[model samples]
Target: MARRARGTSAGLDRHRIATAAVALVDRDGLERFGVRRLADELGVDPMSIYHHVKGKAALLDAASEAVLHEVEIGAAEASDDWAEIARRTAHGYRAVACRHPRVFPLVVVRARTSPVTVAAVERLVTAMRAAGLPDRVVADTPGVLFGFLNGHLLARTGEGPEVPAPVGEFDAAAHPTTAALAPLLSDVGSVAEFDRLLDTVLAGIRVSAASG
Candidate 1:
């Protein structure tokens, strides 16, 4: 059994606690996570977590911030096109979420005020503004993009229902359309598929903005 480490003042900081919490979530499902458990993992008391985070919700937010900070927006900016930047950002987030499915919900709902998240949003807003999007659009684009990325990742990981396997009998009978679409659905797991969809969405957004 792993025992909590001794020494109250072990130089354990809030960032370290939050990082440990994120690691805990990555290893175990969020439903199994608690401050006490995380403290145990960190070899500290539950109260130690409070010294870093206010409560469960705050810990979750910090966990999410930690995950988002893992994204390398600077490295993803190989292309100068705003649409490309957005697509790369989406892909980066999707990759992170896929790597940490237990933390997906936290990523979607964590408060936007965390410094890492705020910096990400600022970077995104600046990109959108440079792309000729209006100030309001720039402000709202992060939410829109984040929602899309979250929904896409959730759908891809089979996080919900296992789409019933294609049935040859049912397919030959009344559900020809769905049967035909089954193969298409099967191909949707590739990164290429996501990139294509992202391109299409960004194109539509560009058109809508130009028209409006």
Candidate 2:
């Protein structure tokens, strides 16, 4: 527990402010988040929050940082095989996104220049370069991999059901292939589905590596 500071500053610090801000956004969401609202949430003056985090943009970034710290992502060991490390990093990143679907958007859209974000990217890129990936492939991999992960996760973890309702059988006369694959089409967002798609992405990277 943070001991309430004696007087002038409302006892607020960056960490406490960050924790409260993230909680506020997690509950009511970004549309309702603001310094005054956060101050009300924290039982402090708006100035107190400003004293710590400066502005709404900075506070949002802080909240994103706090959420990222919850998972062990991009910890690609130097000596580990690059593909294995990539798999591990992908899974960890997925875990965090699954854990915080609302905040996950910030991770995707924000220009996160924090130490945690930097370090994670550094480790993963180092492992990739060590694996002898061509310069272009090495530079392209993170954006490509993360773009896939982000799009897939946003679809799966966003509002509504995890799996879509079955389309049932289509008219075979009009849509033979659609009728045949309707069952598989409805079975979406499973762990197996996520893994298989991730493998597909990795396979493409492998091809890129081979041709590079």
Candidate 3:
């Protein structure tokens, strides 16, 4: 319910505008959001937003950063196992995206050069370094981990139709393997399955490093 200044516009800041925009997106679907809508939400004229942001694209970038910033990586205290920490961090991101499916795509595609995003990446890198990962590995792991998490969440959320509708009960007569695995795929609550896959991936990374 916080409203922008009515008479005075001089107090408006970019952060405040970005925060309002994010709130607007959260309340309404991204497709329904626009500068004018955001301006109305902030109790300011649409032109006032232009003073702080170049346009909608700029505002979208800011909105993406605002959502990403909402992800809390938690205390830096070491876990008993570094791999578990990585898994937990990945799950944390997945959970956030799941809670905000409409906002997740923007976060995934936003420019990585933004200061807020850079800070978050740096924190992850620092944590990886502390967990005994080499600098090169630390630098690359976050990108890979995030990519997987984003893809997994987007797929899980049914953002797009991945599987075609069965003409009639999957037709096991034509394809044996797919039909055999159909039951497994139908299990919607697969968080445990995803966690197991995550551990496998982490183990593979460790093995690859040892081999090299």
Candidate 4:
């Protein structure tokens, strides 16, 4: 075993500190993560982490990058089907979000300068360009696509629009129509839903790009 640093718990370095920080957030969540907690996990002093990372924010940036690296886009396919490319990109992003629901928000809120994130964005932009979308649409598509993805992911995590309340619980006397349509209003989010949504968005983009 690596011996502890003198007057400290164990050997420390940027890689080790960052790895521990990512693990802390993965296990406990971002809100519970902190340098002191990370130090405790590493059996070191709280200040020891500052030497490796600037502060919690910098540490979070590292953690976000770490989590994003798990998303694998693989080699680009040798085709110009932008719809397929967009689908792959969307699925890759959703996989990462589903894997780390808590850490997902970090990638969303923090500045995304990670190599993987950059590559992912580049891949999407390339696809949009290949599709012959207008320059403005090419630039704006990412925001719209990601917004839909984030919304869907949030719903998966129970933080987005909620399913309709049970029909039995509704005031049937005052709202007969709502009670009658309760079964139809019950909503479920699933992989099928995500696939359909991606397909629809891509189709709409194609139509919009063609019309302009």
Highest TM-score against the true fold, candidate: 2
- Model 3, range 71-145, lDDT digits (tens) per residue? 755652355455666776777676767677777778877745666456656666666677676666776776776
Over 1-212, each residue of candidate 4 has an lDDT whose tens digit, in order, gives 24365675456787777677777877887778878788889877788778778988888888777777777764446546767777877888888787777777877777456677677778778877876789877887777787777766755643333442333365788998887776654454556767877889878777778887
Using Cα atoms with residue i matched to residue i, what is each candidate's TM-score against the true structure?
0.79, 0.80, 0.76, 0.79
Error of 1 at 136 (Å): 6.5
Which residue pairs in model 4 clash with each other?
4-10
Query: Model 2's lDDT to the true fold?
Result: 0.76
How much does candidate 2 score in TM-score? 0.80
lDDT of 1 by residue, 1-212 (tens): 44445753656787998888888988887888998899888877788678778999889988888887887665645666677677767777778877877787787767456665577667667777877887766666777776777677766653554542323236345777777776665646578777877777777777766776
Clashing pairs in 1: 5-43
Which residues of candidate 3, in runs, are more than 4 Å off? 1-7, 113-139, 158-173, 186-190
Per-residue lDDT value at 62 in model 1: 84
> In model 2, what lDDT does residue 70 have?
76
CA-lDDT, candidates in order: 0.73, 0.76, 0.71, 0.73
Stretches off by above 4 angstroms in model 2 are 1-9, 160-180, 185-187
In order of listing, the candidates' clash counts read 1, 0, 0, 1
Distance from true location, Cα of 168 in model 1, Å: 15
Model 2: per-residue Cα lDDT over 1-212, one tens digit each: 24355574566788888888778877876778789888888877677777778688899888888888876854457446777877777788788878777777877777456676667667767877887888788788888887898788877766555454334334777987777677676547667777888999989988998898
